[model samples]
Target chain A: MIICKVVGHVWATKKEEHLNGQKLMVVRETENGGGTYVAADLVGAGIGELVLVISGSTARMALGGNNTPSDMAIVGIIDNLEMETT
Target chain B: MIICKVVGHVWATKKEEHLNGQKLMVVRETENGGGTYVAADLVGAGIGELVLVISGSTARMALGGNNTPSDMAIVGIIDNLEMETT
Candidate 1:
């Protein structure tokens, strides 16, 4: 589970069968409070929200498959994310 | 399965009844190869397309769900990815 910020969204007219009617979103990967990559959205996230993204076979399971051809999925919306405050 | 590269997209209209109509994107995290995190297009990726992402609970069964809040999903679509040139 990686911590990220909602940054954008994606649109596709043609896609895989299992992907039909599914939402996608863009989230910037964060680490120690900073940015990393820019990815297409798989969740309905809005800018500024902290979110949790899952990847790999785990991502496949999130969408309910081992053959859906997906590798990432947003599975949670963090109401308030906090690290250990020293 | 976290090797990635796509770069953009996102849109929304009220959400979270299991995130009806999902799609999102953002930026980034990476190590040795460069670039780290910018996610959101649960696959159906374009741009400089080079992607592979998955996350926790196998991203909740890849969408079958352990209570469907979604952690991330984009199971697979890497026509070609290679490392090791020594």
Candidate 2:
């Protein structure tokens, strides 16, 4: 699932201890109308809205993990985005 | 896993109950040698670094559950990304 915005948030106080309670944001990838995909963000979205990111290993269960060390998250938060042009 | 590049960061408080302490970053996607596929960041990656992301229900696993409500996570940090042209 992809169609994003939320363009910013990330700060780490010496990370990797199972990511120590997580929330990260910063997405791009907007293609409901066109193209472009910027990555990074563990949900907690804002900016331009229209989000729904999830990548490999199911993004390590949305951060809870394949032992932390995240891949991607931001499960949902899209009011409306439909594309099925045949 | 996709080839990626992070150009920045994000920060927030009073987000979703499940999205308490995480980090974010954004940018347009990059191919190993060609294409473009910018998406969000979930891993603790740095500028110009390659990372791996997981999506979907399994993304739920990377986090903790389908309950916490996330969809992606950084599954691995890529050291190499190779694509073959047919």
Candidate 3:
């Protein structure tokens, strides 16, 4: 998973059948200034929260292989990131 | 899944326990001139073969949640990519 900050929410009344009622959020990847992408929200991540976004089949697994037609999923809300000193 | 072409192989005698015996291949994503990255191979894709790669938890599902410390997996060898006439 990659570190991303929730930038905004997306609303689409009509979409893939399996995606109904799921929250979609705009996320910006925190590495190398990667641009924004929409991702299905697995956790109740609010805007401005640090989150872990899992992509691909893992994103599909979020809904138990129901074919959500999305590549990214917010799997967790990161509370903190700490580093250790050598 | 994203389309990529296997470029080379990687060998690491010591790695995450779940990654033992898995084949690692270098891949270059076939979009927007993306750079190369390492991914675990699932479809026996050889160098220069266009393949589908799944990332994140989907990658972990490649090994049944064994925590393989990888973010990508070669899921299929693409025989063709056809776009219908607009």
For each candidate in turn, the interface RMSD (Å) is 8.9, 8.8, 10.5
True contacts kept of 3: 0.11
Each prediction's TM-score against the native? 0.46, 0.44, 0.53
> How would you encode candidate 3's per-residue C-alpha lDDT over A1-86 as one tens digit per residue?
55678999889987878888778899997643476999887657889987656566656655446466887777656554432111
Q: Residue by residue across B1-86, what tens digits does model 1's lDDT show?
A: 45556566655576566655555554332333565443445547766665555555554545565665666555434454332211
Find the candidate with the highest TM-score and give its number. 3
Error of 2 at B22 (Å): 2.0
Any idea how many clashes model 2 has?
63
- In candidate 2 the C-alpha lDDT for residue B86 amounts to 61
Error of 3 at B25 (Å): 21
Report lDDT (Cα) of residue B54, candidate 3.
82
- Fraction of the native A-B contacts that model 2 recovers: 0.16
How does candidate 2 fare on TM-score? 0.44
Tens digits of per-residue lDDT for model 1, A1-86: 78877665444444444555665555666665444333334556666788887766666667666645456677787887767765
Instruction: Put down candidate 2 lDDT per residue, B1-86, tens digits, no spaces.
Output: 55445544433333335644544444324554432233334566775676665556665556665544445455566787777866
Residue B20 of candidate 2: its Cα lDDT? 48
- Per DockQ, the best of the predicted structures is 2
**Model 1 spans with C-alpha error above 4 angstroms:** A32-44, B1-86
Candidate 2 chain B, poorest ten consecutive residues by summed lDDT: B32-41
CA lDDT of each prediction against the hidden true structure: 0.56, 0.54, 0.69
Error of 3 at A47 (Å): 0.4
